[model samples]
Target: MSDLNKLGLAEARDALRKGDVTSVELTESCLKAIDDADALNAFVHKTPEIALERAKAADARIKEGDAPSMCGLPIGIKDLFCTKGVPSQAASKILEGFKPEYESTVSQQLADAGAVMLGKLNMDEFAMGSSNETSVYGNAVSPWRRGNDDAQLTPGGSSGGSASAVAADLCLAATGTDTGGSIRQPAAFVGITGIKPTYGRCSRWGIVAFASSLDQAGPMTKNVRDAAIMLETMCGHDAKDSTSAELAVPNFEAMLTGDIKGKKIGIPKEYRMDGMPAEIEKLWADGAAMLKDAGAEIVDISLPHTKYALPAYYVIAPAEASSNLARYDGVRYGRRAHLAQGDGITEMYEKTRAEGFGHEVQRRVMIGTYVLSAGFYDAYYNRARRVRTLIKKDFEDVFAAGVDAILTPATPSASFGLGEMTEADPVQMYLNDVFTVTVNLAGLPGVSVPAGLDAQGLPLGLQLIGRPWEEGDLLNTAYALENAAGFVAKPGKWW
Candidate 1:
């Protein structure tokens, strides 16, 4: 079953169900793969013993003729998600020692469906960086390029580890949070399928918040089918998260329509920005052509406020991140800084904060504090919110004009060398999220699927933005494209 490494979760589950394999055996295979792929650092904490035990329990249930929908499936929970006994640090030194007494609603839901928790995975420190390099544990290397040599490409972040793990076959599927493209960007980097669902679709109750309003948890997997199965389990309402909507969670798995014949897909005119790399431009055109070949009606539409999304997202996300992170004061949990005897209460809080937050985290905190400050609130934060409303309106207007969904490039470029972004200015990094951040701001469902690869052989992803609560259309379109644009580039023999 060595070749089983690249098999989709559904395929493996079928194998397990047909007596072709056992949960214990599959779990052991994944465990050995993790051990063999240590350089990927996909996992912050790997618990083989617990994983195997859960697998055995699932196998026993299968034998007893009473297995849950996700029995025997292995998943990687992003470290930002809390686990009962396992640590969840959000990959920051500040929350380094913190462990939640409770599991996140998403994690608990998955466990109830019988998914085996492989372990907590790594992320950007406090989910701040676009690349995984900002993790306090150091960057989680992309397993595809063989550790840190040769290409040494980034796996994307802060869900880089999740994407890399899923792409490299270290895990069947993984959980990811999108504050500002965390889920989609990394999925693009590692050549995997990831969905950033409708904001309230997946309850955010135990996820470590980056930007409360924008932070959403979703699934990252090798293909759309695996993501559909996991989304079925995680998408639901919970009383704990007051922001959680009371709307009924649709049968996401059952709704993945295979036929896209005659559906209208909008090609947003704003996305074809000037100076965009030619290779990416070709990828977008190719994607549109493929959809046209699949009997889709393509029309050029305008999101007039598209250029304003990045600025608006930066302001709003940091503003919300600052408020959400205030709970990290040394009093309850995580790291604490030493203070001098003369240091007063204010100094204590300040010093501990300075010690706890990393450079990117501090940058966000500063931006957040500034915009929300007494004098700047109206000028910065509120104005950005108003602009966000207009952006959302743009999408609604297009959909009202009979567009099934809007398609665009997931990122400006494919996976770059690991340190290429980190060494650049922070604005450059923020620009990376330019294409994907608006979906989260509008509380809409968005997904990135492998469209094609660049000339360098790195993967390129095309994003589909759906109307609020219309993930079904977005996913169906993705499935159609996945079949048409068949570009699957695996890692080579040499690193």
Candidate 2:
């Protein structure tokens, strides 16, 4: 059981049940890994005391013979999730010292299932950036590096730390919420698996709001099986979240039979953007061939409104974010800026917000406010809403044509240097979400599976977009791809 931290979720679960290892040992192993990997800036807050206590309880639970599948496993919680009495900053300065008295429903469910939380992992400030550089805790560096190159790269955002931690084996898996491609992009960047369940499939209660309509929590794990095992525990109906799906929790792990024999996987033509790297293009073609070899039908499909997804997302997400973030005035909890003697409440509000939010968050809030303003509401917000409908309809039309899943490149490119995109026009950063925003707009299930590596040996992933609420089928399709690709490359231990 040496290097117990490297075991995937299902592996650790079975090992604990078989008495081959104890939860405390696994927790300690992960804690040690987390401590050693601070160079990556993944785990922003460490909770070793709480983790050890929970591990002891999980060991006792396993001994009782009625343990759940996640019992006695260690995992990381994204900073977006509020753990009872733990710092839940969402990686922004505004919520710096705010600790919730209650736990987020998803994290609570995992805790109830006997999963030990290592700490709050870092992310983009308020889940607003494509790269991890915008975080108050600084960038969550990717564990992966370009072949023989020493440059640091971003793990992808908002959920950057989760991807870094899971890929580095600092934890067996981590919870990540995807507003756009926060979960999937990072998963792809770090050469791991991440799934964003259909909107409302997982409870959003207690997770900091970042575009309520698009935010859905899912698992970032080392493999599809680990994702399945973790996702099953993280999902279900929660009355606390109006957006949470009221559906039965399927046994997702059992659904991974890896038999996509007669399934139809759509290859969206619109995903073939101009200037797409030849390496990415080749990797995509190779992925389609692999799926075809697995006995799946690869049909050409059209999501015509794909080009409009990014604009629609930027508009609608920022609009919702502006409204959601308005609650963080100096009056309530979280950080409050120091005020002058003559400062009124209005001045206090203005000063606190300007100081608290990061540049990216401020930029989005302003854009949101401007769009929702009376003069431009119809021209911006309303039009964007209409475009969102068209985007959703595009997927519905494709699915009606009997497409079980749509396959596309998860990211336009592989992991880039830490400050690469941010230095140029901010739009460059927005382009990173081009391949992923559509799924969020359509409220569909999408999973990113590491398919192959690029020329520099950096990992590239292929996304499997599923019919709404059909994550099981999507995951099974991804399982077929995973087996075909046989991608087992782990980043060399540079940290």
Candidate 3:
């Protein structure tokens, strides 16, 4: 009927269940959109054959009258998720031509629920970098433009493809992973909704590990309701992953009553950094005002260890990254360097890594190795771990003091141009995660709700951080924020 791909997840699911439309029709619409939107480089690996096949099966399942809320919905899969028989490269060259014979637990769950996979979307190489610039397939451009300017902006990463595709209406929703704001930052930049559930809520069985402790898979969608529905389908305990919480999955969509009365939302004083954009500051205040008007109490709170989150994250993430990435030394899977006749095993390892990893991935791996090395372990890695503990405790103390949720700006500012940050000082790029890393360290749930637009017309989002194991409550709060903000802006389809 009316452009099937334009419908949100819940809308499409209802339509499919009512016999108003079939999953095949919806999947085909998204497939055509993916072909038309290739200039954005969002879908790195298109699987039209599999998508259509799955769509046909989903239609049958829908006819049987036992389909889930996500059943027969077309969605984009982030390249990081291992889809058995499909390329699961993590947008890195080292994993070139590597296809996992096993499906990632989250994707498998989604598939089991009858969600049709349109294709694997692009992302930052190995989920590194703030922008999508590190993707081997190329930069995934934001659909938004700044006031008649043709210059391209970044749909924040490493979930840029998910953001870009969803904003452009290429898919109903998409899967994304957050290590340090990867999902929320991109969703904020593109004016959509993304939520990183409480750590260990979703199993990390087949998703390539960047930082095992911090990395988590979640849903990015057009609205809070859609996000809630998709998140329910994505989260579950898996015996394959030890970190996965052995807790029962809740009906997150059903929990969205939007009545946030008496919810005490905390405003962290430390998030008001020096030189913060007046627009972002005002947006944060506006979001707090919206929540207050919705009957939630706004209270000022302190997270004294907030200043150390970035430094601690850099140290801890890279240190874990160093260990997790060590398995890719050309012996088991993925790309291998052509060895010279006289070259030894050591030479093969060095050559393979040197040839495979991009500059940013290499830099992090080196930093990770350095921190975990003999002399600096205590000075850097161990100390950073202790700071992480302090950061987690800060959130715990606030929540223990009766705070229901915390509010902050999702990104320091709206999306910037693609090549704005240079390699000379990569720290500038790393600074993008300043507002989000604390949630990861604390293993709590957080959501980004597109609240307003910047002066340049780029989308700006407000974040809600919730208590551990309370994603249902968090999604309810985000639903309130989304309803209050009334943000319906969409990027013009220039691609």
- By lDDT: ranked, best first: 3, 2, 1
TM-score of each: 0.97, 0.99, 0.99
Name the better of 1 and 2 by TM-score. Answer: 2
Off by more than 4 A, model 1: 146-149, 493-495
Candidate 1 accuracy as lDDT: 0.85
- Pitting candidate 2 against candidate 3, the one with the higher lDDT is 3
Structure candidate 3, residue pairs in collision = none
lDDT of each: 0.85, 0.94, 0.95
Put down candidate 1 lDDT per residue, 1-495, tens digits, no spaces. 665656677898788778888888778777777777777878888878789888888898888877756788888899999888788889988887787899999999988877888888888988888889888888887755533347677888889889878887877899999987999999987788999988888899988888888999999988887778788788889999988878887766677777888899999989888889998899889989999999999999999999999999999989998898888788878888899989887887899989888889998989999999999999999999999999989988998999998889999888877888765589988889989988988888899998877776678899888888877778888888888888677665321
lDDT of 2 by residue, 282-370 (tens): 98999999999999999999989889899989999999999999999978799899999999999999999998999999999999999
User: Which structure among the candidates has the greatest lDDT?
Assistant: 3
Better of 1 and 2 by lDDT: 2
Report model 3's TM-score to 2 decimal places.
0.99
| TM-score, model 1 to reference | 0.97
Task: List the candidate 3 regions with Cα displacement exceeding 4 Å.
Answer: none
